[model samples]
Target: MKNADNSRRAFVRFLAGSPLFLAAGIDGKSLHRLITGSTRDQGEAFDLIDQVSQDRQISSPGEALDIFDFEPVAKAKIPPAHWGYLITGTDDDGTIKANRDGYAKWSLRPRRLVDWSHLDTSATLLGHKYDTPIVICPLGSQKAFHSEGELAVARAAKAKNHLQVLSTVATTSIEDVIAARGAPVWWQLYHTSDWNQTRAMIKRAEAAGAPAVVFTVDLIGGSNRETMFREAMNDTRTCTNCHSGGQPRPGVSGRVDDRDNRRKPAFANPAPGAPIPEAGPPTWDYVKRIRDTTSMKVFVKGILTPEDAELAIQHGASGIFVSNHGGRADNSLRATVECLPDIVKQARGRLVIELDGGVRRGTDIFKALALGANAVGIGRPYIWGLGSFGQEGVEAVMMILRKELEIVMKQCGTTSVRGISPAYLASR
Candidate 1:
């Protein structure tokens, strides 16, 4: 009998070598329908992929996996600067590399023949049950990619019965996004120089029935995203949400002096001479103000330290997301996963510990759960799907991951997410 890790490696290798998956004969629509339909039954992961491939007149799941080769497609479709902004890492990308490399340091210890037929991937976070243990990480400026923008993303999330975290710098208004999803969504907030504006945004979220408020704390200063600047030099397209205030001018430091000296200005076509609101720096008092203003659950994002995690709990944070801002923030920070064990230990279950960074496979989801994350957030991949096929593309991304997770659970001799624990992993 093949071990679980070997099977996964073989599957990945098969995907690498297979040509049939890329052939034009396979209709993406038909393949999508078949895979989604199989989710209802106690379907085996590979079985569904195989069925989809065959129905679509393809050779195998390996061929289908080729669709994820994002670099070439993304490069061709997006402008060079935009591509750089989308793909580049902060400060030489060392931490970005480590974010995924860290995962390799931990190996799975799979058990066999435990009668693991019924696998459940459903998870509940902050008192809400999600179809999958994945939440949509808040990524701003969707209009930069597609005209439908955030609305399209929201529609996709709603279609999959998944949760979405709307960014404070979203192109669409909070009310509009909530309306599009027709349900409560999570809102991601950043502290601004104006307390009134921050308070108002929280009130708006509450009024719109937002389930949680995720305060992003890592971006006290804007990241050194040179790609976006390069792109702006040629393109007129600006991040509507971020540009609504006004474009900042070049400061003495030669960097764009954004109204909020905290964030770096990356968008184009800023309203001329408009006062750039300062973000200054944030304090724990801001957190308390946020907590006092909203009845919704408060989650602090960008936490990678156990001490910060503990401090968040003390400041009335109901949850903490261990993220490196998708490697867009500090370049020297540790990978979010590397800090999870310690943060979880310090949190002591006082707050929900969610993680998001370099999660591209079903095993990645499994790894996070085993190590101690309440749930994981799916970021760039879903957006890549959106960029490729709109709502259908998003659906495909989720389906692929959910199916992979099911297979991982069964092979690891587990029937439910609850069955996952640190015991399932060994230090590499």
Candidate 2:
């Protein structure tokens, strides 16, 4: 009984210094009572305390325990419609779940009895070195989640030395994001039907110091995002103030467009019958055309098959971004991680391979690297931080992932990112 009392007292003291406790501004007595169950009846069955205030919600960025910890905070802070759009997947939402579940098919094989006092997590892609292999995947209209939007994300990326891929429909401009990042960033292209406009956007990105252009291709035809529609129905705010174009906003409806009239200066004039420059899909020729149009490296985003991966090389792509548009592009239920090995085999070191979709852990990043991915990407995790606590939250998420990755590296006996390979992983 004395030991138990001492343990409870020590735990309460530890909680007093915890980020969650400090940020939540809980008093020592309250924390002590919460930990001791002082209000409970003596010898009562230990179960859920229905009357206790939930401690899961974080009040500040420092309070976040992991990447997922920010989700509820973000959900609570962001409007219902935007939160729905942020979490939406096409049709049945099976693909979103699959992307996360696919990691279970593989297991890690850690090396034993290796000294790992000094570790490295740096990765290189297209001749550029970054601190970590975790790239910030393109997320459009980040302002819908937070006021600072991509700018805050860029600052966090710069601080953590992670590469950021800016979306075509990003709330902030390319030049500004670059300025905030203090480095060049890759730009994601939508490849709309207007060839002239596409050429102009590509050139514009190159002019803004983007070293590469990632052309997203899986969103052919359109998607049936029932989740976004359902959430938007509950939004009580007036849509017309910003979405005056009589169309669902880009991020809200999953439709890419310059409804805010932000792209008129950089985008080309509308071609015949193609009023929306961000609409329509492209063929392989578009890839070749983009390559021809710019000296910057061209990456083919949303390549999920070995055939498409091979096609990307033939079409003059500098890299293959293995993704399913975060499962928003289709209802195929194919996770990007599941497609990595085959695509890596087909590429055969011919191009840089990167993937993003449902990556929430350091082990997921390690598994991707082991399967021959030069780098990995993340979408919702950082945004969760961004929405909850702006720039600080973004930095917290990056550091958390990096620390987790470092711990995994030490356990696996790998000194650096390049040292991780298929030999360290086994099929489950």
Candidate 3:
């Protein structure tokens, strides 16, 4: 068995260096099965790539072996400061690690002698069915990562038929994103503290044919993203171009006054010397008001507790997006996955339960669904793809995750998204 494992590793290493490996777009999980065999009796770790070299650089989206491959390429292509913004989490960044670490607590128990073909990954959100259970979490200011930014992401989401939630601080306007996506997209609200501005934004989104408005509640107060501060020190570009109010300094998170109007089109053209419109904590009354103001379904994002989840349902929220703001919000050190079960129970199917944060694999999505998540959202993974190779990169990342989910469904003898349940999982 040891000899066979060594031989498989040797062959994978050879494949890593070959031209075909860079061009063939082979599945990374399949390679893992080949290298680790049916079991890991010796507990050897799965290394997707044991050898890294310039010669192995992927020139196209098809060349990427997994979702992780896009990160390094995105780093190579994006500016250091912008990359820092994308990578940073609050405080010590423990929450980010926790989000990924939380997945290790659960293990899938495969059932044998069952047909696994003809798998259906389609999922329904708010009476609408999408091609995949995976949805895109709203990431503001995509133009910072790529020239086309949200426009590119919109096109990619349209091509793959994935649901997209556009950020209030998105570089592109709601009208443009809808036009680019070729369909109505969900709008994530993060505008001014004033109710009028908020109402106007929601109305604009409605005018654009948005069916839902995701009100993110976690980022009311700002966070200390130390990593972004550190990376900004290395950026010699004229910060005033985008950050006209002032450049970001060490120990100081960028304020709304410091940002360029072009970066946040949602708050574009405010009165001169007027106070900047920023995200603030929304009360239950505020949520009810939002519900009363719009015909669109209201999804309350960033609830991490059963109590809060219950409150969302009480306030007429159509859904609960269980997230820790990708660990970029306050460092709560609680993973969205860890918070999912209780919230799901509290919701009791009263509202749709979706989650985002540290979803890097199809297995992660499967775990969330098993824990009672109706669907899951991904933030950084798709952004890495967008930053690395533009629209094609985004499409590739979604396709890779869809394929991975399908493979896991087959291996676990599950035939459909709704068919996945807690019975298929055990605590590790």
- Global Cα lDDT for candidate 1: 0.71
Task: Show where candidate 3 strays beyond 4 Å.
Answer: 1-56, 250-263, 269-281
| Residue-level lDDT tens digits of model 3 in 109-152 | 98777787677899988777899889999998899999999999
Best by TM-score: 3
| Candidate models: Cα lDDT each | 0.71, 0.82, 0.83
Sliding window of 10 residues with minimal summed lDDT for model 1? 247-256
RMSD (Cα, Å) of model 3: 7.8
- Per-prediction TM-score, please? 0.76, 0.83, 0.84
Ten residues in sequence with the least summed lDDT for candidate 3:
41-50
The true-versus-predicted C-alpha distance at residue 378 of model 3, in Å, is 0.6
Q: What are the per-model C-alpha RMSD values against the true structure?
A: 10.9, 8.8, 7.8
Return whichever of 2 and 3 wins on TM-score. Answer: 3
Off by over 4 Å in 2: 1-55, 246-253, 257-280
Model 1: per-residue Cα lDDT over 143-184, one tens digit each: 656567788888877887788999876668777888888777
Extract clashing residue pairs from model 1: 21-63, 221-262, 222-263, 222-264, 259-276, 260-278, 260-279
